[model samples]
Target chain A: MPEGSMGISNIATCTAPVNIAVIKYWGKRNEELILPINSSLSVTLHQDQLKTTTTIATSRSFQEDRIWLNGKEEDINHPRLQSCLREIRRLARKRRSDGDPGLDSTGLSHKVHICSVNNFPTAAGLASSAAGFACLVHTLARVFGIEAELSAIARQGSGSACRSMYGGFVQWIMGHQDDGKDSLAQQVEPETHWPELRILVLVASAERKPIGSTSGMHTSVETSCLLKHRAEAVVPVRMDGMIEAVQRKDFPAFAELTMKDSNQFHATCLDTYPPIFYLNNVSHQIINLVHQYNNYYGETRVAYTFDAGPNAVIFTLQEHVSEFIQVVRHFFPPETNDGHDFMFPCVVLKAGPGPCVVDDPTQHLLGTDGWPKKTE
Target chain B: MPEGSMGISNIATCTAPVNIAVIKYWGKRNEELILPINSSLSVTLHQDQLKTTTTIATSRSFQEDRIWLNGKEEDINHPRLQSCLREIRRLARKRRSDGDPGLDSTGLSHKVHICSVNNFPTAAGLASSAAGFACLVHTLARVFGIEAELSAIARQGSGSACRSMYGGFVQWIMGHQDDGKDSLAQQVEPETHWPELRILVLVASAERKPIGSTSGMHTSVETSCLLKHRAEAVVPVRMDGMIEAVQRKDFPAFAELTMKDSNQFHATCLDTYPPIFYLNNVSHQIINLVHQYNNYYGETRVAYTFDAGPNAVIFTLQEHVSEFIQVVRHFFPPETNDGHDFMFPCVVLKAGPGPCVVDDPTQHLLGTDGWPKKTE
Candidate 1:
């Protein structure tokens, strides 16, 4: 996607955790700069269960910059990909010009080879782009020795990608500027702040969404009056309450706000002129089950938030996780009791670290020859 | 329920057509008085295909006030029912006190018996309450020999019932009055104004809705900010556009406004706390089919609106009805081709008269004995 490091002898591999927005980021104000209409908060899930590993290798012998996604080589010139590459290299040059001593010695502008793959299914409507871009930017920074304020660059790749640059509870502030320079993600709390907080990603359907968020949001901004009102009046207050709930570890408050924000997001979708329906029958069934389960407990024990798809990302406390999983199983029975289709078919995760370099050479996605390696 | 016409010897029978709101009524400013928070407009469907017939009889030997709905006796003292009964009697008494010569001949005060039934299924969620209450109030008015303004009395029965009291396109103005005397339904245009407009009631599900409109609107008024905004800002402008569209006989303009208003109503439902979902998978599929069919024609040939349940009410020009019905059948095949459950299980309706006296003695719901008779 971009010219590789000046002269790096070693490949850089980094893993980025997927972040699920509780306060969803839907419409964008500035399409080109990827600025959101409202501030959103999200939790970065543990990389151990779900993550994207991206390895970038630079070589003087390489003919051109190339990229491989999920073991398949794809166009390196996709507009958003190009934006990420341009921003990262511009920052590297700035660092070198400022005599930061981060540039390598060879002074050779080499072609780049990037290989990225996710441990989970990309078709599950998860925020894979967020993790992909976050990992790419994080790896590029490591290669170029450029460290400060990288989230702004990641925002160019994908709007929500900026949030995955930080772990645990992060807020992407909707700044009031034409250039969107101030709309960057800030960490509200680290992964360890709420150990009791747990996440379950229930995959309702593995099919890709019919309409992408980019196009769906474009129509919403143009047609949906509710979305405009929400951006102007509703979200400002919700963002503050969400941050406070995270800071205080108030489970009930956080759960209620999260669920309400999610419903409001989908409501705006329905309010669109022709209307957009992202949640299907299974999604509705899961929503009903969650509400019934909470009502049975006489409290808000668990909350579910969906992001532009049928899959549900659940938020619950550690104490309720086991029982809740059992309850979910009781309602939505798996097709098979065998190990393959069993276990409720969801990943139990927690808040975890953001993108970081992998120190082990054996885990590198590229060979020492600066080429893509074939995995078993 | 009201002591029937100062004891008229003859039973009065009246039929009222169902009204489907293009501009929905979802909240209340005064619950007891049934004053809506926003003005709404609806089309009264033709009575031949779908209507409610009510008969009222007064006799000196009759017992306390009683009522029968769909061949089953129901509580006569239901608060809303009582409100209608009390309001009508108060108006009749005032008329008598003013020396009105048009009052009935019989001066003997007697108890009343009322019987009501629908030509269509009551559980279809087809605004049966609107038709039922309109028929009730209209029958009572004929029995009492009072006819100055009866829509306000019908409003006390059910909010939408006010619209059904007038023929063709009616607009119920959300008047600002503590007593709700000014909140009344007025005819925007008679049924003969437009002969090309057609409607189809697509029966998605006949099952009773889990939450009734009365209670659902209560929750929405209390919890949904979008509902308040729609009432205060959105619906007023929408009401004007809808009335103009109906007057101009602009099918596209009318269809678009109808679809948009219905979407906004359902959007507010989803924005409620814990949220309310009225459209099921079939409803969504029908919506998609309409959009796709319209897109295929490169024009708005058809439009759909859903109320508090899954059934879809379609609006199209007379020229497009047959083609659109064919498209709907192609998408959603009927389970049977027999006379029963066949024909797509829908009634093709057109704008028609409001409530009127059914003069034929043999057509009366109540027998000559002044009690409910067994029907074949």
Candidate 2:
């Protein structure tokens, strides 16, 4: 575990929103530093479908700084956990004059305790880690009263995680060279910039993975040169187009690029040594059906993109929601077949304010200390 | 509704394949004749997923030759049905003194009873009409002993109906409209040319549509100018690329073009006025999941396409089917939920022959004559 030699007391918590990559981040330049090979841009999912709530508590009663996640006490000694904790401490600004001696004037020399609970399932490929790491870093900064830009701290955890620090449009700069220092995320635009732009996340199947992003990216980078091209060529172009699309409110351009980039990214994965199969028959059917409908009608009405799992996030204007729902309803009628379930309720979220702390922690997180033990 | 005189006394039954329009035939130059503005392409699905089985009977005991579909006597006077029958009879050959018509003679006149049953649901965007028309033509051809190319006769029913004439990769020729006699389908390559290719059909939902294809296409063409650009600019290039991909056995290229073509076609649909929505969250999620898995692994693993409705037809290399199946299994796990059916076992067909008449018709299609009444 990342340990604490000096004495400290009292704990504080923090929260962060989930993000969906628009200009996807494909390869890595520095795996250890979590530095990206190219810049990536993502839209922060309004803390509903994707969020991470983390709590940090420091007490004299604690013997060491232990970390727990989603009810299970995780070994903080794991290199990833250790690296995240250590990096946060290094950047955290000191609050008082030698108040505890636990954290030095440099802020790097300190001990902290972290307990996090993700609102959604991890390893389901819904950007849970992006939210988790962003939350952890955000909470740590709050605990130490440090303000060194949360993205800077988030960069140390995962490249994409840095983008989750801000709501709406966020871009992660893929920096140059081997030391992996200059890379960090910056806000391009906020969700409020275009409130009419709505997204519907369709959870296709909530299946867990044998390999998580940590190793998946590594395999992808080593075996797949297409991954290299996507990181080097496609993402850069997509990034520029995305920024412009967001700025101009060009739905067609936005829809076209998002769909193309996503298809290309997956194509590169297929170009990898041993192919990966992420999409099922249902996924292809949806894409085909959407394309057919769009062609049949003749324009860009609803645009869709997918992350690691089989779930889909659809981007549509407010006006077209009902028509979209009705067409889908006809094809996927609520017919009960031998023990299988299929339903899609067009979930609409009235764009809310950016991320804010809840009135109370217990009710918000559904348990005590934001780390309730799983009853099941 | 193409009727014969009261003296008909014999019956003939036949089956034909349905062809889905990849480029899609949404606009018609002549609505009365059901002539399309642009050519389309489709693979005739092996009969298991979709096909039309029809029986034609002529009886001296009967009055005017009548028609029955799914065991219910449908309106024989429906204009479209009458048009189809009249056109076929116009070219039908006459019987000799022996009461047998030779294949050499063109079938210019025949008044025969007609009955058809779609193996799958009609008006579900599975192109039941395409198969239905093709079967009607083929059965009449057999009954009249006409030897004209199947495509030539099918065209009289519906423009896209011609493409269902041959198995494997088929292309519809967009002949000059000075005379509408030449537009017909031709086999690009036989099914034997690409034996390694496999198509997986996901019956997402079996619900029928409110808008029939004829009306739907008419509305789309009249209102949506984007459909014009799609037929002219997008489809030509896609057709070229698709043909080349198929010739080279380049799975990735073929898959990419097929998917791209599908998307472009759908984009045009959305561009239509009063935008059409053919895909839902479930469909979108499936698309995302497929792309994610393909991207994660980094290879050209699978290619997917969808028709007018929500059903997805996935084309993949025979080798990677297991991996594809595994990924699909993980996402759409067979589990009970809210009494709504969601998942089913993915069916894989061993390489086999195309449609052949069932030894015992009662066991599969419900009736050897026309069809059984709708159970529900």
Candidate 3:
């Protein structure tokens, strides 16, 4: 047990990687339960390049549970946040009740203070929520001394967050049960399975905030008949195909399916009653450039996928990375005629391991006062 | 009979209105026959505001068949052009063989000189093909002295052009016949059915030529699985609902379905492999403004649709036309801060009649030389 000035507290620090979906999860069957309409697959990106660092501290004398995201305090009463917190506590209590000897019985009733920050700028529009929730669940599990499966708890925060539970290739099985107990993230393969695979994120300069995936998908489910058909017919085959592509280390097959799935997802967005526009001119240009580059080589050497924003995540092999990057730079020159930097910012990353626990004392986000430490 | 410099010729001048698809015709099941994968519905705009005036002459002494579009001579050897010309001749031959006494047998094997022009600027990005092909087929029928269902012939020129063969609310039935002989356009209601309905073409200033519908739909059919689902499952039901909406003159229901179908069409475009982008920032802004205006009024007053371009074709009742147009002008200010005329040009029109011949001799495109006269 750790002692704060006011009372006894347990603290844990952990970090999670951002996962980019190839076969995307669009609509939720159960909004409250966060159960998706179809199975989804993703590639967990390297934590060193992009990650969320979360510090969780549970104290006996704390006033209440609170959370500060990226140096700014947020509403702790947000329903999704409550869902994650409640699920994690329930799991901890279940472990104790099941006669798990390793359970820390003291922290079960304690209030928690969470400090979460991303290494990358949140404004960059790289999916921070997946990493945020995954880190929250991982750190909370460590603080409570509960080590059982926690992907379901992470999913209660965000539908896509469940895929971030494991590194390398992961799949979220859309189970049929109403209770959603079987709908959990499973690792298809380890990080070392595909050493040559590379991911490059082209961060577009977004002018306005796009519609949230939650509300956008809600509209799709309610109004888009195309979406319903895709969920029922198209995705099951795609889920199987993507899993096979990952297992076989088939780069071209994987790339083609990624791009197609991304296109179909945006298609569903357009099919929504009011329609949604996610990709902008830059994103369009990037897509064209990728295809043109691949066509020039007489084969598909690169693939691009977009989420709910203009940014594009490209999948390619290590051998083609340098040439592809050069091609991108050539078309969208970094320096404009007036010497201003006008190019889209890009981050190159590779497949990496899952969430990690930080054992170093100096890296702790919470101080002895059971509160976040002041930083310069 | 009219006498050219070399020989006698039969000449006919006609004009056809541009029909905007509320329910779009996208993919084709039989490319050669121009048979669509799904049924489509459209509203024909008044020819007085926007139309293609085409003059065709069949002369015995003409050297070869030729066509001039908007003052520029184009190759008559284009396959679609050949398809139209062959189909018209075949129909005329069939009529003659059947001993139709009204047929002009003398002009059966004569060569044709075609000159077509639009009342509005061709660069405005409004769909010219629908009206252009419809007028061509209609005029050719008159010049050849054959009076039969010519929508089938026009369909061989372009799929959507078949729908333009009729006025007011028309539907191109995606018939199941393998030979495409039964695939034809039918009028759901005459132009006078909906007196208060109006169409406004918000011609967006296109910076570059968009992908032609021919190649665009080709790519969509080959790549987009969502399109497959839409054509198979979604569109059939939409066609029924839209026809009912139009028959009942239910403005709100009609508006909702029109907007949704248009969105789904563009969504299919996005679902294309390389992903075609027809809507731009200006198009997006207009969509937002329309929705925001409708939400403010607590009713659907206006609905919008787009073809293979950024221009928005709005469907609204005559009572709300002025207000909607005012709302449009307010959101997209005509004058920019720099005093440049950046306003999106608009053309207001209503449902009108089908192609009609001009009996006035001065309206003929070709002069005595059996060729198009030079225009200043």
lDDT of 3: 0.87
Residue-by-residue lDDT tens digits, candidate 1, A291-375: 8989998999999899988888899999999999998888778864422223354788999988988999888898877777876
Identify the candidate with maximal DockQ. Answer: 3
Candidate 2 vs 3: which has more lDDT: 3
lDDT of 2: 0.64
> iRMS of every model, one decimal?
5.9, 10.6, 3.8
Give residue B89's error in model 1 in angstroms. Answer: 0.5
Instruction: Please tell me which model should have the higher DockQ, number 2 or number 3.
Output: 3
lDDT of each: 0.86, 0.64, 0.87
Put down candidate 3 lDDT per residue, B89-166, tens digits, no spaces.
998999899998876688888899999998777645676887889999999998888789999989998788888888
Q: Alpha carbon lDDT of residue A180, candidate 2?
A: 62
DockQ of each: 0.51, 0.04, 0.62
Q: Which wins on DockQ, candidate 1 or candidate 2?
A: 1
Error of 1 at A31 (Å): 0.7
Candidate 1: lDDT of A54? Answer: 90
Residue A165, candidate 3: how far off, in angstroms? 1.2
